[model samples]
Target: MSSAHALMLQGAARSARLLEETQAQWRASGDDLLLFAYGSLIWRPDFEVEQALPARVQGYHRVLRMRSRVNRGSPEAPGLVLALVSGGSCRGLVYRVARHDAEAVLTALWAREMPTGVYDPKWLVCDTPHGPVRALGFTLSRRSANWCGALSDSELLHIFQHARGRYGTTLDYLLRTVDGLRAHGIRDRELERQARLAAAHGLCTPTI
Candidate 1:
């Protein structure tokens, strides 16, 4: 592993501590906790949720702008993942965890998402089919060390083609995320375009 990877992994303990602090704050509220899912969380929340409903978050759009150096790639060849960057709106899911299980659910969630502390977890308003609900969302900072911002089609294709990490290849992560969105009746045109381009270039197999 590269020194960059080692440096990123060093934040794991810090991330866990921050998550615990956040959990404590939530516990003090005595209310059901809601989590917003826009990417992998939609398909692989891994937490026991009481309800999952179609929801929308405004002022932020889903884009493949976050760099993954562990779960989906390496230091030399990082992979891309979706992040809620400022602008537009995103259609996704809002998961509600029971007040009783919130602590355990949050613990597991942090273990999965806060490995490198690249995302800023914040409370955002979600427009659900039922009604508007405030939910905890993991938002990306353009200033964050892990932010990849925008990349050209060729760059994305190269990473998707060659990058792999402990979980799987970058292509696998993208395909699964797109599939997950489709399963929820949401279609992301940008992601679709990239996936098609990658397949045409024989970089990655088309799964959409």
Candidate 2:
């Protein structure tokens, strides 16, 4: 096989193994499975959820600082996606999955989010209106190859204009995320600022 194709297969195998390990760990813990959603998961959770509550996770905040090579952008002209980086706090939704359905739900989640094992999945304490719940959250390390760190306005504008993947454009993803957060009465000023930047440049119509 070609070298690039072989690397892709290797990444896929690693992702599968990681998913299996995570599932085994969760099963052994004997606790309810909770998923923390901060981005597209907030709008599109393709699994059956027992309950979804507005949750805030401390010590990590959301930022559109990851490169999407398959879902939201191409490899050549990569687009940005959200990830939970260290420091600050994040406001999003936490989904509770019934014990009976956790396995199936997690399998589907792995396929969607861990296609190449780009994220580090961790069990985090999410504070909800009711109480604190331990939830599975995806975080990205700054050292990861997919980490975008920080981008200037020109870089973002270029991605907004050119990047497109199997799912859709990066601009659409950002707009949708901002809309989802707004619907939950969660105000993320930084995300809103990016949306405004896009609108100001006439890249997309304002939705927030």
Name the best candidate (by lDDT). 2
lDDT of 2 by residue, 1-208 (tens): 9986886797799788889888998999897789999999998998888899999999999999999988889879888888999999999999989999999999989888888788889989999999998899999899988898889999999999999988899999999999999899998998899999999999888666
Q: Which candidate is the best by TM-score?
A: 2
Model 2 clashing-pair count: 0
TM-score for each model: 0.91, 0.95
Give the alpha carbon lDDT tens digit for every residue of 117-200 in model 1.
Answer: 878888889998798988899998889888877788879878988889777888887888888999989999998888788788
What lDDT would each prediction earn against the true structure? Answer: 0.85, 0.90
Q: What would you estimate as the lDDT of candidate 1?
A: 0.85
Q: For model 2, state the Cα shift of residue 197 in Å.
A: 0.9
lDDT of 2 at 200: 94
